[model samples]
Target: MLRFFFVLSMITTASVSTSGLAQSSSVQTAVDKNFLELETAVVEAGATPIASIDHARLAKAEGVEMPASRVLIFSDPEINTPILEENVRAGLDLPFRVLSFDQDDRPQIAYTDSQFLKVRHGLNDTQALNTFESKLLEVLNGLDAAPAPTSELFADYGVIELRSQRSVPEAVERLSTAVMGQDDTVWFGEIDFATEASQQGVALPDTVLLLFGGPAPGGVAMAGFPAIGLDAFCQKLLVYANEEGGSVVIFNDIAALAELHYGSSAEPHHGLNKRLTSTFRTAIE
Candidate 1:
């Protein structure tokens, strides 16, 4: 648990996004079966269904009826707390959900990948989060006869360590400028984590999470892979006082994160892979 934090930090104000239950485009159609069987099985699998949304009835009430669209939200404090305890923004992905609906009169159930949280929340290491996802998927698989969605996928995110020859603020300023120069859509946000700690009388070095992202690729990234929303918007730069008395700059590996979430298609959609590769070099150096 603490291992993942080395990169994401204590997870407070810097929080933004994480898409739990990464959905697969492959699950295009619903299965012709009883939704109750799935529901009961989900409970038996150890995850509680906290809420259910009947989209068809709700839409019908508005006089614009639709198919049998139902959404089930799950709650497992054991599965959710590890993420929420670190960053509250993760609540968006919480109550973890599963959607069951009549698509063309066939019933379909969907589950998202938890790894999305690791990328978006700034978790440096993903082993713990990936493990939880695997457990959740195994439980869910027991509920449905069909195969459960892919839960465990390795995303090799690269973190560049640039030994800043200047002051912390100066290095951040240069990096921010370079990120923006590459593309105006790339913007930045900064949080003074170390300053907050010093206020509590705790001795600490200068530490900050320099967050950045813009519309150029973000909108396109999500447009291609809606799931990438969790990974894209949260791109950032981490600067802290190193033991050597100088500051070290760390940032999310765009290519690694994009490929992880979008999988193979990431290379062509708006040329994300190529763009990210160039940016990594530009942003870090």
Candidate 2:
């Protein structure tokens, strides 16, 4: 019995690599299916969904290595929701790609039409689209180089939205000037809930402030690669707020983490979480 068990274990081990990594095709298929499934659920839940794809896989499968970042944001509202459900169960994967830079000094993946098609179909193609793409690449590389948002940048054009019950002008004045260094700006709005609280009675404010930037009520901000953004933003907000009062409901749009690659809010790094908490502690105490 012992020899039989040992032989079985050996056979299993022989079929797997030492690193325990699944075959690239298997991993790729799994990821593609998972993302598609997630998209379907999100749409069925009545939320608008967007997908960001990595387009370097085609070249990689053909023995090429290239560095590319391409994300696709689209709306398929006209498609029946049931079609989406059928697609998920059928394991039909979206035509998408993956990107990575390698040590061989070549791009890990080659650019291909399938990848570009997703982007072309999704974008509005305004002249600014070119500028935006360039800016996004710069921001991603910058985060890899120096993981911290320039507060001064926020001081220049960043906006803040306060709750209706709170005084708006004062909040703006206090927050706008408080940001030091980078040229960031602040804009203000008020969220007003009606007495009856009907959806029509309550207007969703156009401007949202991520609490990680100022206060919690307006928008959620997060950390990590672009893929995990929503989760990271929500996590940091809860960490900073710590079940506190409503005074800090406004937010400043600190750049996404990809823009700030090196530091954190805690003492060792320059992140929004640490900076906001530090500011609050000094003010409250």
Candidate 3:
């Protein structure tokens, strides 16, 4: 039996609720703000804005019509390091994100709640989680947006895990190379959770996260529902050490994400799920 430290059942189960807490919080802005304005807001809040994806523009270039939508990825090392020190898996949600989109002709913003992250990754640092959540909320409140009720967009997001014979670093390298080799995908970058934890004077097993996306398929999915980008846009694959002297790889289940954001009738974007599974399988082998 593989002694995975994290709860495999919790991650694999479909649409699991975070004990009644909404997975995300959304608000409608009183005034319209462009993508650049939103990005500036995040930067001015003391978080380092890492990247922004203009899903609407990307879809437009592909001949798909999508409302104005964008996702901003940002992080405050001071806030993130402490939480990561408690549970390295929290890296999966770090470099926090906010999604802005046009809904009913009104500009709206949505972000994952820090409480959701604490539950999703089984984090135990109450102080750190509270601090992170407070900072994020401060940024959203500054936008002059009327807060909407929290939403449980998905019952629970699903995760796919693959056991690898190689070490964590080796598996990460293999997966990164394989993902980058595909012409349809673009490699965004990576986050080294173990290293970040170490910098905070905490010892954690090797863990790394690779961010990449297939714009063609991802854009199509966003065209259907722009809000899905809040959770599923930039695909992430996590490689982490296990107690058995090997490593494990994990990523979001595209099919589950589609059903979570879209309805059960939704299908994985253009067979992208199958291709992603195949890529990870080969990388692990």
Candidate 4:
């Protein structure tokens, strides 16, 4: 039995917008549970655990050494459906994830703060967001973990967007092919927001999300700070239809994200960022 201690840090005063929302975007929590234990807790809380990524194992396979780190992607449609109806962009951040990593020999867990999601997505449904927050808290509390003092690990969300002359579907297919064409890249899966919304009787513009990453760059990034895997390991590209019927493609800026997690934008990150930019640009063009 492996025992891990996670420090849960909730940002109470971090504000992303000047609208007085008074919410932060990220939270780190401490708990006495391992990765599997945490996954079970998520399922017991009635949320669906979609994927679990072991960053340490991936690094090992790539001949890189890193501390133990993993990320679990899960979702609760009941809590997210309403929010999605309000803002479909939230799909990029949805299927909530919790990261477990060993830092300084002390294991820790962190997750995206729902209140921050509310502001990030411009969601107006307070009740739905509150419910989402409570449901996450329920999972943590179920582990019998206590909250600790907050930390300043929060950073501004950064993404690069590209306009596509093609339609959303065609752009998504092209982007998928482009990503897979890259050396060492892996296409995890895609989420179609428009299809999901249509099933729920809500109309939304064509929106699709593509998740892909390679151990070479991703492992290299995590070798610096394993926690970065929570956000940067699984690279995401969101393709959506614009008002003009064309498509727009967006993805996380690796340089900005690397700086946010590793405290500086190193040369490796710059190279990776350029590579990603070129790949997306080629697909859309």
Output the number of the lDDT-best candidate.
Answer: 4
Off by over 4 Å in 2: 1-32, 49-198, 202-246, 250-273, 279-285
Better of 2 and 3 by TM-score: 3
Worst 10 residues of 2 by lDDT: 1-10
**Candidate 1 TM-score, C-alpha based:** 0.43
lDDT (C-alpha) at residue 16 in model 2: 50
Per-residue CA lDDT of model 1 for 1-285, tens digit only, reads 011111111211223243321121112123213345556666777876544444333333434333444444455555554554455334334445554544333455555456555654555435647666765575566454232223434332344345654556666666667766763343333455545444544444566555454444444444334334333443545666666666666554555545554454444343654564466445545
Provide the overall lDDT of each model, using Cα atoms, as 2-decimal numbers. 0.47, 0.27, 0.66, 0.68
Q: How many residue pairs clash in each candidate?
A: 5, 43, 3, 8
Candidate number that wins on lDDT, 1 or 4:
4
Q: Write the per-residue lDDT of candidate 3 for residues 164-243, one digit (tens) a residue.
A: 88998788878878888887676666777777667767777888877777667777766656666775658877788989
lDDT at residue 151 of model 4 (Cα atoms): 39
> Which scores greater on TM-score, model 1 or model 3?
3
Per-prediction RMSD in angstroms?
Answer: 13.2, 21.3, 11.1, 11.2
State TM-scores per candidate.
0.43, 0.26, 0.79, 0.80
Candidate 2, residue 55: lDDT: 27
Q: Per-residue lDDT for 56-91 in model 2, tens only? A: 332233343332222222222222112222221100
Extract clashing residue pairs from model 4: 6-30, 6-31, 7-29, 7-30, 8-28, 8-29, 8-30, 9-28
